[model samples]
Target chain A: MDIIASKLFFTGIDIGSTMSKAAVVDAEGVMLGYVIGPTGAEHRRRANMVMEDVLAKCGVSLDEIAYIISTGYGRVNVPFADKQVTELTCHARGVAALFPDVRTAIDIGGQDAKVLKIKNGKLVDFLTNDKCAAGTGRFLEVAAETLGLELNEMGRISLQSDTPVKINSLCTIFAQQEIIASLSEGKPLPDILAGVYIAIATRVVKLARQLKVEPPVVFTGGVAKNGGMVKAIEAVLGMPVSVPPEPLITGCLGAAILARDEAFKLINRGEYKLQKKQLSEAYIEFTEKTR
Target chain B: MSGYYLGIDIGSVGSKAVVIDGSRIISSAVIPSGTNYATTSAAVKAEVLKLAGLKEGDITASAATGIGGRNAGAGSYHSVILCDARGVNLTFPAARSIIDIGGQGSQLTSINETGQVIDFSVSEICATGSARLLQVVARILQIGIEEIGPLSMKAVRPSNFSTSCTVFLETEVITRISQGDKPADILAGIHRSIAEKISGMARGVALNPEVAVIGGGALDIGLILAIEEKLGMKALVPENPRIIAALGAALIARG
Candidate 1:
């Protein structure tokens, strides 16, 4: 028995479509460390390795971690998690932790898009578009490819569209064509960039309306770092949007907090409804009985 | 004597047949492409006959445009025509840019003031402009092609799809769907992608206000909106946009 492993901590892992993230927190809900890795083709296998590496890097042992929670698009694939939470709930909790007064959370992930309405740090209503990646980080990446601009450069370049063309078309393919047409027309590069920003901002605003969009809106996900998009969104909403530091990691942090809470609940009760799956003989007997 | 002409545009995905009496289209028919061009042509012929009714036999001549433009001949050689500057100029005399987007590919032609093909761009590699991509989305979401447009209009928070390439986009769409996005929003993303690609192709061409859009894909409201939004100018779409190319061909034959 290692003494270092005896310390108490809670862990949260978010298995996303493109990447995986892990976070650890103490019993007091104070986050200590975080780690991120690619969620390659082998999702579940990669998740385990990522979690193990995160624990090692954070100088925390598996024995010290009281509970493990999983979140994100691939949450269900996390075999080691004690509980799985929806990205919606986790994003709200994460934003709430960062910005206690945050009433709205806009999370644009790699493969999906989400908008959360938060009241008192709790999720009220949320809208998400997981059917296509037309307006998300992925779409921006694709559009950037046509312009031969790097992902980071798109926001800066988009700020350049002089006319600030409106791309009302909801489809990514149509948008691509429209962009090509603009390029052929010799429209200034900045104007095209500005147009893209407005399009994305318009999409977010449209979704934000579905939920009660109150001020003090917090933006998360990889797209939050796009200053052009941020300004565009602000201009559309006619208000300042707050962005949490490390917005992408908030989901993992929230998961860690929840894990810490679970651990504390178990410590005080001294009685964990033992996860039946942990008992080999009892699990077999239960399965046999059910069958 | 005022003479009328008929035009037939048989493309890979669909067929458009139109009868032009001077500048106005007397009748038009749009039908899906079956197994082969012959079958599709036959279908178009039947549909045209049905639409033209009494005027069907009176059509003095006919022309063909698009991929099968060279071979779209009925029994009569005097009635047949092919896609060219003369064909396009017959109907859209002032057209500066003629955009044709069908199910399989897209064509962008720049016509000078004299109604000549000055420069043109074609997209044959990327499946972005094809209906196959939309078809895949519809199948996965269990919706029809027509539903994609209206559903996309309802997207509160539309999803973003990167990758103008069709194969890559299909994977992205699947990932989004599994992530729990609305199908309508997803469809919107697909439309935007196509518009972006088409817009890129036309980037360098000096755009003339008298733009003419003719293709089967023109029926998709989402795609048209994307073009309009990006160009920042309203383009004229004939009543039956899909049959415009055919009308242009027929008008040429009438001459």
Candidate 2:
């Protein structure tokens, strides 16, 4: 797959804890294609397959691609990429690419959640909760398993609750017991579910506030799709939140766009000649020591 | 004539009484382990008599099990027996694993072929069990205990409240309420959440297909369904799910 060399096509790959997303962009910041897949068995293997698949679909050939930039927890494993970026940088860049007017970005991923503040498309400061899977996507998945609801359906179910249930505990175990006790006493199901959404949103708000949220703030990541969570967050911040279309794939797209820019720079330097094998080795070395 | 045996299991949250005639369980009783054992025992005795149509002298043998079992005194005797004897045959032969979900915590006990405890596991902390969650639901819904089960089934899309900790879950529930959600759905969500937690332990010991559920929470149909949903298997609720522990103790005494 190849695109005309009129404008450089950058490719960004973000391999997260639960999902992998890839984005391709032109010099003008136009997203070529945003693709996603489950983070498969191994870091490198899944990243390779997903990247190839996404690139193939967009008709963007490896030869046409300028520079490849990898980001996220699994960044080091992008076997064929030229460079790797931190999740913080990638998230800020990804959000800024979409809503350049925004200075604050909050991303809730699978195993970890983060809040970042960006200035002029550069990440200025950020806060991340990597301790447990409590407020992240995994916690909601576990909760969904318990409730016998599909992960996609929780948002809709929460909307039906008439009187929201109140859960004061922040610890997952105690909150479950509190919920169980409430169930035994004959509380409504919707209310209890509503309480749970509120709890998660509260955690997100706390993290966002720590970074000093600015208007034109963007909410990105898998958790942003949860309607109940969004509503709770909106209530807490007293502001309307913006969630990019296909929020999960934004980080990857940003990485891809960055790759395009690097490729143009390589061309300008007349240093665009390197074996794929050498490129892979250098990328791996940088990732191994990026942290 | 069939000799009537009585077994009482006093746990952290509540007490259970099971009356057995030979190999058959005539009836059972379940009451909260509120303030003291005197009142709990008396309440159990009254319930057993009411169900079995017999008085104290009719009970040929009696045994006790659970956390409060040792504390239960018959106005004089103060020794709690293990109640793992191989006497009064269990009515349900498939009940080899006994899970007690009490007020304070939960315990998983492996029962031998003869209804004796082979190994048991208990939660380490002092936390609210199914009873407390039930109370929250009751308070939120303003409905009787009998209503939650039927109403929970009505939810088309059940809310998923996540948590493995009882204390943390309380705060989560409160957050949900503040977010403009209803009480019934929250109750249903809580039921499923706890079922998942309890099932995690049950899965640890290779939960047999015909596992028996015992505890005050088991009385709630919603909780039972939640367990079934999470385990992907049907659960066997004893004649009186809450009293199974006490009844098991009684069976031990009879043997």
Candidate 3:
């Protein structure tokens, strides 16, 4: 009943470890709106709320969306989704939509860092940090905590430093100790910040190198928004990197694009069926399965 | 010969100074190492001297060990791996393998019959294997450091913790707390993780029998139990676990 009637829309939700995001696109694969919010403890609840918010922002109701997809670490927790896809695949699709020439994509999420090899906008090979927090966004979060500075401040301050110090510890906890020691020894904040970025870049690039990274590398994820991180990765990788606008919404955007493609395919085949979305039923099923 | 030999361990979490007379531990002191070396070493030194009823001048020779051991003002400094081996041999003569969980790092050392280090492994990748996590957990739980070990024994089933990365683990622990997981179960899981890391670092070196667990990690009864369950053996612990390295440094100074 809430359908726009004139146009068909596609919806995508990404329930990441740290944040939940949702995006809506028209049949032309143009993003109308996106919303990113804290995932919190209840993933299923957050996913639904985010979808509602994004739809409201786009002036489209859930009824207008032809297909919906979920992605990211908590993708499986989304019961209302028609399909679930991996963040890696969603990211590749999203990046290829933005940078058509992207051969490599690096996505550093809160819990993990991934170096994905992309061929023709499709994921080919990838490498991720092996259960180590060495090369992740959480490392920067700890540095921010230790320095008593905001996360945004790290990138801006690090730009001023011409000489960056080396961080010896691979672990974020021990790196905090090293940072404390540096602060006591009168090391400048900018130098330390630069060093921290370089440390993350080094670890991530090490993973990227193993994949035999090619040119036209694209960086995405919340960490990609930090200018210093991009510069550090570029310096370590000895190549420049491009970033998409609104870095956090890539997975959701990709999901929405995929939703659009799937819906169009069904429409072309005359096999399209208006999905009977039973949120309550899905929630009950989820609870029963979990129990 | 009548005077004492001193050994100081300037560790990241705590500093310890031991006074000994020909391998007989006369006195020792441990004080929290807050930020840097100067204050902690000074406090530990004064406390040990007070315990021995002697002034700093009364020490004949002194050696230092541990992360910040260089600033201990000792005549010589030794590696923590060597100190652990020497101290373990003295405490448990049959001990050929040692796991020392210190503030900054958890180390596993393989030793010969005479306490010479055959090989050593430091959890080089991260501090997840270290004792620092216990302090952080203690602060989060708002409990005394001594209470965590005993309280962990009460866990009916230790909670499963997937990641040992302290940064990730802290958030996970907080979530567990919010999700109404019992603190005892969380602590038990943490102890088990530390045990696993120590064992993980001992991958290449084949551990000889009569393994000993020393340093700060050995002080925790719950951790010992978890480690015992993990290794399937009874691990030896000295009377005063924290002072082993300082004791080894002192024994070295005596020679």
Tell me the chain A TM-score of model 3: 0.91
Find the candidate with the highest TM-score and give its number.
3
lDDT per residue as tens, model 2, A53-106: 877978877655557789988788787888998888888887888888888888
Residue pairs with backbone atoms closer than 3 Å in model 3 (clashes): none
User: What fraction of the true Cα-Cα contacts (under 8 Å, chains A to B) does candidate 3 also have?
Assistant: 0.47
> What C-alpha lDDT, on a 0 to 100 scale, does residue B40 get in candidate 1?
66
Strongest candidate by DockQ = 3
Taking all chains together, the TM-score of candidate 1 against the true structure is 0.56
Decide which is better by DockQ, 1 or 3. Answer: 3
Better by lDDT, candidate 3 or 2: 3
For model 2, state the Cα shift of residue B212 in Å.
20
| lDDT (10s digit) by residue, model 3, range A57-149 | 999877667789999878887888889998888988888888889999999988789998999988898888757777899889878976778
Tens-digit per-residue lDDT, B141-197, candidate 1: 778777777777777666798666554565567668756788778887777777777
The clash tally of candidate 3 reads 0
Q: Is candidate 2 or candidate 3 better by TM-score?
A: 3
The DockQ values of the predictions, listed in order, are 0.04, 0.07, 0.31
